[model samples]
Target: MRYPSKSALLFIAAGALSTGASAHMGTDLHSHGSFMTGLLHPLGGLDHLLAMLAVGVWSAVSARRAGPALLWGPLAFANMLVLGALLGLRGMGGAVVEPMVAASVLALGLLVLTRQGMNAAASMVLVGGFAVFHGLAHGAELAATGDAVAPVAGMFVTTIALHLSGVALGWSLRAANVWATRATGAAVATSGLALLMQLA
Candidate 1:
């Protein structure tokens, strides 16, 4: 696959730097604690959307170059997301969740930008680690309501669907233009950096 040109990289960096400050960290879904609320929560934040998509893209790209087993990265993310959410339900790890969620976006975007591949085990661990923070951020919001099963389940299903969609996109991009995938990664990475700045 071809690498992104220096100019392209510079442009992406400039755009990221120019992004307006905004935070979608503490979304309130407590008013209607239903499956739809949980399902839509991931779509509510740019950070969550990009990070989850990046995971799927990374998994697809990695599977093509590495092995089919690497496709399990998304599953690892889903499982860990639930686990982290459970912890969040108990009001644990509230302090650093949002920052970590932002950081996950940055890390996952870089992974896609480079199209890096690791062993399946290592890949799952990395993805799972990032997913925990995402789950924690959302789960913390629901702590007070104490009704987590339906919402968490909805979030879980939506996360998988998003990952699959990303996988399809990544696969198609890889087949048509490798550069497109790289550009997508660059944009995602830029968004991640912008989100981090918002947190900062």
Candidate 2:
């Protein structure tokens, strides 16, 4: 089965993005300091949701060259996220981090859009780099929310779930036709662009 055309994909993306693409969590999850808070924080923002899913989408599409892309990409993101949390605990990041996090959506969406012949090493770096910003955000929140490892673990688990969803979405599209990946990529990238505009 064939998916929608490129134009259709872009149109869909534009519509989605135009409908308020910025990602921000208004709820004060940090004040609670619980594992549930970690699980829910990622879902609070459009940017986090899209970026994490794009990572999984790219990895799933990229696994044809090497299986490492599937595991390594997510691993890099998750570990770096923990590291970012440490930095947050120390109050290392500030306003500068927000734009970086917003930009990550654009970058990952681009990767998904161009999901052909990507270097596994480069992909890891890209995914890991973007993850740092996201991690910092997570860390910044968790640090304020609570001083417990459970929250971190909960956050990690939620991230894994999001990645898996992206992987599933990518593979399902791949099963239909390879071109669908590009469509998916375009959609994700367009969403990122919308988020960037919101930030601006």
Q: Name the top lDDT candidate.
A: 1
Predict model 1's lDDT versus the native.
0.76
Rate residue 1 of model 1 by lDDT. 54
lDDT by residue for model 2 over 1-200, one digit each (tens)? 57754433543464376337446655464567777877887877777877888788778776784354577787788778777766776777898787887788777767777775456677678788888888887777677665657777777888989887777766665565666776677666776777677667
lDDT (CA) for every model shown?
0.76, 0.72
> Candidate 1: deviation at residue 105, Å?
0.7
Q: Evaluate model 2: give its lDDT.
A: 0.72
Q: Taking the tens digit of each residue's C-alpha lDDT, what string does model 1 give over 1-200? A: 55654434543453354355344533654566778778887777777877887888888765646455645899999999999888888888856888888888778878877888887889999999999998888787766665789889989999999888778766765664567667777787777787778777
Model 2 residue runs over 4 Å out of place are 4-21, 65-68
Residue 153 accuracy (lDDT) in model 1: 93
Error of 1 at 100 (Å): 1.1
Query: Could you tell me which 10 consecutive residues in candidate 1 have the lowest summed lDDT?
Result: 14-23
